[model samples]
Every structure is written in structure tokens, then in C-alpha cells.
Target: MSHTLPTDIRLHKKSRTLELIYGDINYELTAEYLRVHSPSAEVRGHGIGNGVLQTGKQLVGIKGIQPAGNYALKIIFDDGHDSGLFTWEYLLDLCQNHDQHWQDYLQQLQDAGASRNDGMIARG
Candidate 1:
């Protein structure tokens, strides 16, 4: 949970990708991931007490990151899931939980009888 500061940051807008260098570790963040892992209560829910599943975000992309405050960032998603304010801690959480969380999301979608043929939702 202790993350080093990023020494370098790069954004490929055309590809909706963000690359960061922190000490010896490098990270690649897709706009899609940022959009789905938005820090909004609408996304994470209140204090982790709720289980709101996010679907139909396979094609969602981050339009931009709006400054929310000194500690949080407002992420704008192309799919209109732009209400989330992602903090550095939250972003780190997303990175750490990426694999498990993504699998859970996929399973949730499958349970709901959904498919990603459209690739319009994040479920794919």
C-alpha cells in the first residue's frame, strides 16, 4: 500500500492510455479502467456497505480528469459516469485490486445475463 511518487507521467490521448513511472515500478492505466474504478459513491458506494455493480462500460473512456480538490480528482467518463472523484488512495486501491475486482465484475455481469457483444459497457 505504500506507493512511490511517479517520476514521469505520460498520456496517449488517442489511445486513451496513461503511463507512469514510480521509482522502479511502471504503471499503465487505460481510460476504461479509470472510468470503471471511479471514486464516486455512485461507483464505490458508501463506505463499502453496498454492492453496486458497474456494467456496460467496455467502451467507456476517460474524457479527462477534473480537479476536485487537493486530495481528489474528478474523472470524466465518456459513458457519462463522470461523477466520481478519485483520490490517490483510491487509485492505488484500484491498482491493487484490479484482477480480482475485474473478475468479480465480469461474473456479476454474467449472473445478470449480459454480454459484451456491443463492447459498449465495461462488463466486457
Candidate 2:
């Protein structure tokens, strides 16, 4: 309900990207990035060391974006991940620190001996 909310949010199927426009600034987020960085507890886990690492999302695409009240967007990934509530602040942070965050993600995968081509991590 605030005027600071994003004016436009669009998913481009051809490009496999989400575009967010807020005032005069615009951000383009790849579905891959969104998937890897989902805000769900399933991805983020419960505590500091409990976070789950997401892998093999390089080709993921956004299936849809639904509103969560007036504060966040629920993004459904083509891979069937739909629990994350992407709040305005979180989305903005992702847009601003994407490069660093992406690098960290790649490093995490390397450290875990994981490959982005291997699909999601198998959970028991």
C-alpha cells in the first residue's frame, strides 16, 4: 500500500527473466538466480548452520508470481519451488547485491563439490 512499492513486475518467458521497475530504477533477475536464492525455509533452513545449499538451477525459469498481501511476492519456479515469500526489501537486496551473491553461490557449490548441471540436491 506504500508508494515505495515496485511499479511493475514482469516475467519474460523468452528471456527467462523477471523485471522489476521501481521509480526510475529497473532490475532484471534471472529465474536461475531467483531459484538459487529463494527465501523459503526449505532453502534457508531453520538456523545459521542449517541452511540448505541450492544447486543446478542455472536453467530454471519462473512459472508465476503471486501477491502475498501487500508486502511480498510468491514466486513459483518451474522446478516446483513455491514456498518463498519474496518481500520488497529482499528483492531489492537481491537486485543490488546480485553479483556478489552469485559469486558466493558459485563458491559454495565448488566447496561442496557440486555441479549446477546435476539438478537439485537429493534430500533424504
Evaluate all candidate structures by whole-model CA lDDT and list the values in order: 0.66, 0.88
Model 1, global lDDT: 0.66
For candidate 1, the per-residue lDDT at 112 reads 66
Error of 1 at 95 (Å): 1.7
TM-score each candidate. 0.72, 0.90
Highest TM-score against the true fold, candidate: 2
What residue runs in model 2 are displaced by over 4 Å at the alpha carbon? Answer: 1-4, 120-124
lDDT of 1 by residue, 16-51 (tens): 866656677777777766765666778678876575
Which pairs clash in the backbone of model 2?
Answer: none
Candidate 1 displacement at residue 84 in angstroms: 0.7
So what's the TM-score on candidate 2? 0.90
Quote the lDDT for 53 in model 1.
59
